[model samples]
Target: MTDSLKKINKQIRFLSVYAMVSSVLLLIALFLILKKDRITGNLTVEELTANRINIVEPNGLPRLVLSNVEKSPANLNHGKPFGIPGGNRGGLIFYDDEATECGGLVFSGRKDSSGKYFASGHFSFDQYNQNQVLYLQYLDDNGDRKTGLYVDDWHNSPPYPEFRRTYKETEKLPNGPERDAKLKQLLEPVNGDPAFAHRVFIGKDANKASLINLSDKKGKPRIQLIVDSTGEAKINFLDSAGKVVYSLPNKANH
Candidate 1:
């Protein structure tokens, strides 16, 4: 070949090499930018849309999750689902240091085919390894609405997951004496401590009564201070049997 032709071929090869090297460098730069965006922050966006988003700890444990109904997660115990899988409503779930579910906020509203409507919102916090100890909830079942804040006691012996497992197993049994007996046994107190008990309720009931109800450890209502819809107010003290043993403004006082 002539010298001029050889020089032309050399120029073409050099251009080809340069283009390939430039493409590789561009890719490396893009990858670094993406990694930095995820790990170190400083990236900004105007908007983002997604079905579910999970924010995790450095070790990959989930710290928080925001999700839609179809992609919602179930109750998590130490990072594993424990209760009815997929039973949890769409909402935000908060995890504790141990990766256990510590609290949550959930809400839902819908109308049935029969034209009945229902809505509910709940915010609750759980005791370590147990169920909710405090909560505020609102429920509307076909327009019968009740909103309340409640405090409760739960057993610490059986971890919540174990208790739920046994309860689910008991529910599988046929409706009979055996099933009833199992339910009673499972629900009864453990070594004199109640398995679960509602200790206080402060809210408006379906009857439109604003009230404060205090219960004993066994969950028996011991006292109630109420103001009915008509604005009539009274205080009632009850016996363990749940019968009101005393009331303010009795016949003698009135």
Candidate 2:
């Protein structure tokens, strides 16, 4: 090849290489800036409401906790990633940890003049039930949202089977010899103890689970299968009148 032609080809090669490098550098810079911006306002109210609470970066990866005081008690999972239960996406679950299950009164949602669903906490307390609700925000096919309770003739959608379950360990305690020992530990009835016994609800779920109903004999149990839990549990198996029917680990009367 002629020297002139060779020189021209080398210059063209340099220019092409320079263009590719420039394009790559520009993309990297863009990504970094977006990353910074993404972190600034990452925690949305939708997350807290749906109980699908989580933190994400621009790329949708989980957020790291700088310290405990800054973290909501709900976010602490003892090393598991923010594994909110709506699968990889997320979900909305309404609940009231302080309410009694007798009549299901506690609710969290925006209540408008017509008592339609808005964005607010309008909890009520029955004689024994407390009006309180927690919001869950999660990303689903419908995207991020805040779910709430259904009040007196209030308009609300049906429950999401995937987001909540109230009953604790629904299947029976497996009466056979295999599970007898462990079942005894979990089902120790509070026959006459002053301390109330309870099966706690702990998870991202919001649906009220099946109650732990005792058999005709006070201490005999009937396990109603339901989803996992969400960390707010009181110790009591309420009667039809919202009083304690059975408690775990029946205490000895002094």
TM-score of 2: 0.27
TM-score of 1: 0.89
Worst 10 residues of 2 by lDDT: 154-163
Give the count of colliding residue pairs in each prediction. Answer: 0, 33
The local distance difference test score of each candidate is: 0.90, 0.35
Cα misplacement distance, residue 105 of candidate 1 (Å) = 1.1
Report the error of model 2 at residue 246, Å: 31
Predicted structure 1: lDDT:
0.90
> Candidate 1, residues 154-178: lDDT per residue as tens digits?
9886898998899899999999999
* Best candidate (score: TM-score): 1
Tens digits of per-residue lDDT for model 2 on 153-192?
A: 1112112111112113423445577466444433332442
The superposed Cα distance between candidate 1 and the true structure at residue 139, in angstroms, equals 1.0
Off by over 4 Å in 2: 41-191, 197-254
* Candidate 1: segments with Cα more than 4 A from true spot: 4-8, 175-177
CA shift of 60, model 2, Å: 13
